[model samples]
Target: MEKAAEFYTLEKGILALKDQIDALAETDDLDKKDRIAALRSEIEKEWARIVPQLTTVNIVQIARHPKRPYTLDYIAFLFQDFMEMHGDRRFADDPAIVAGLAFYKGRTVAVIGHQKGRTTRARIDRNFGQANPEGYRKALRVMLEAEKFGFPVITLIDTPGAYPGIGAEERGQAEAIAFNLKTISILKTPIINVVIGEGGSGGGLGIGFGDQTLMLEHSFYSVISPEGCAAILWKDQNAFEQAAENLGIRAATLLGFGIVDKIIPEPPGGAHIDPEQTFKNVDKHLYQALKKFEGKPVDELLDERYKKIRKLGVFEER
Candidate 1:
């Protein structure tokens, strides 16, 4: 359903228009043909306006746009000499979460992200991009390695959420995520995180603590998904439209709330339309964000990070 070929939003409307066209073509009446043409025009106009202002649920599907740039896609485009590291040492390698040594924009950086495979087989193989506890642990280990080596860390978050299955819970999913947050808090290397798609719940929190947290426009982050919130708050799953509005999950909304540092604008028609352009924009911002702290002292950077985190709920009583 999150696949790329389904990128166009007006598919259903367009399909109806096509069906009308076919029906009119087979009919004996010229009046039916004229009606079909008028109907097509109306559908086109309505879709033109709605496509750009797509809803959060619609965006959720688009964020997973099969054609969207995945971690591996961007990695190959922006980095070279990627030697993929494997496993937590305590467990087997996890494909859902990919952490490895990479040369990014001519600098050696340890990179990690949720890796959703491209095809049906790939999705099943990747567990639909949901990382298990072991995966998070492996990612934390790689980040530490990057810090120890003084190499910057680049974390890309794009998941519905951490795996919520019984197996993951048995292995301590919450503790594994907490370990990442704790590790990232004091890690010496400059860390940069980008919410390339759906940065859902704790799965994102684990990798999201960074000097700069960026989000892609049309992407979303949420404590609970719209459907989940609706099911709990309204007692009806169909109230997702209202629930999405209340969630404050959009990238622009998150930036307004200071939850994200910046919003990376995607190409018109969505990121799936021109991933190359999206990648370029991301590359530029990342360069600026990385350079901002490149020459700064580690202790000062550490202080700045702590201050950034602490500023979240500061208030003044008048």
Candidate 2:
């Protein structure tokens, strides 16, 4: 069974007990109530022991958990009065990249993110959130519009990587991604980026630069996915476990490297288990971050942003 994985064993066992408790609790017997209470305690103990010892691969699995919330899910919970914008005028709209204007705590902001659909059909339609050149172009257009109106930009990054399709390359995928990096770096408005899920490659970077870069506790951000890394380096796709360890993609690792500005705590058992609490935690931090940049001059913001970027990967000679 899939639950045979070391980390899943405990979680699956807890969930199974919970299911039994739920069924038994529906009865009128007082013994059943006692049994349910005992099961709950056991679940708590199992969770406490298992979560801390989770391997990087286990965290990666949680990050990609099918039930875990996605970009659209966060947008729905975080923003109000969302009005989705579509298309790169030069080409057809790309469903993988969702861009628009929305009200966030009474302020209108431009929002862009890679959107992965839930179902098989929807995933095909969204290209599994692997954006193409036109998607990047559409993102650029919306971001430029946001700059024109002086609205802060908020980007949620969650892509496996940009599409590597033949047509995407023919249409200049590299140029499109490069354009976003160049333009977003110096935009006069404040921007915030949150890596809500897998932050893979240039696809993540295309919308990732911001005044404040935040990451969820269990999320992973890397230049390439572990499987890709394993295949390239070891010629063995099954060596992903080794790749994940060496990649330094965890939020804690990125935080230690000064790559991410802050780490937002997720609910116990990952965000999927308690999305409401996760949403609240994110909202609080995002509001606090926005407030920090409030009233700062655009020139100051730009200068500080440049300084921050320049400081990455710097080390003093010993």
Candidate 3:
């Protein structure tokens, strides 16, 4: 069984036990009640053992899990009065990227994210979250609007990569990503980036530059996807597991490297298992992050952002 499926099975068993306990709640049997307590303890111990031992491949699988909440899912849960902004103005609207203004905790903010879609038709419509140049442009347009209106920008990243189709290239994909990187780095507004799922390549970075960078516990952020790296180095896509191990792209790894400022803890067995709890965890962190920048000077924010960017790959010789 796949790692994610293993976790799913385990969680399913726990749910079944809980259901049994609920069903027995009206019973007068003391033995049944004691059994319920034992079951709960076992569940807790299982989670404690499993979560810390999750492998890189397991984490990658969880990040790509179909049931994991997407950008729009989060917007619906965390924001209010969301008015979706569409199109790049220069080109057509790209379904792969979603951008807009919304009320987050009663504060107006711009929200941008990759939408991988849920149903098969929806996934096709979103191109599996592989954005194009126009998508990046649309995101940039929203960021600019956020800057003008002095609204903080929050981006949720989840993409395998930018679309690699010939049409995407013909439309100046690389240039579009580069422009976003350049513009967002110096944008005179607070920006928060969260790697909610697969943070892959320049696609993730296109709207990923921000004052605060965060990743979900099971999410992975990488310059290249494991499959891509395996194909390049070993000429075998099946070696992706090995590639994942070597990439050091897990939230804990990235946090240690200072690549991600914070790691939002996921519920046991990953976000797919308990999405409500996952949303609450993300909300808590996001609330704190927004508060951190409130009333701060724009010049100070820019200076700190510049320093953060400059420090990314800097290291001293051993």
Number of the predicted model whose lDDT against the real structure is largest = 3
Error of 2 at 116 (Å): 0.6
* Deviating ranges (above 4 Å) for candidate 1: 1-7, 11-52, 314-318
User: Can you give the TM-score per candidate against the true fold?
Assistant: 0.84, 0.90, 0.91
What local distance difference test score does each model get? 0.82, 0.87, 0.90
State the TM-score for model 3: 0.91
Instruction: Please give the lDDT score for candidate 3.
Output: 0.90
- Candidate 2 residue-wise lDDT at 226: 89
Error of 1 at 291 (Å): 0.5
lDDT of 2 at 286: 85
Better of 1 and 3 by TM-score: 3
Which residue pairs clash within candidate 2?
A: none
Error of 2 at 87 (Å): 0.4
Report residue 175 deviation for candidate 1 (angstroms): 0.3
What RMSD does each model have against the real structure? 7.5, 3.1, 3.1
Alpha carbon RMSD to native, model 2: 3.1
- lDDT agreement of model 2 with the native: 0.87
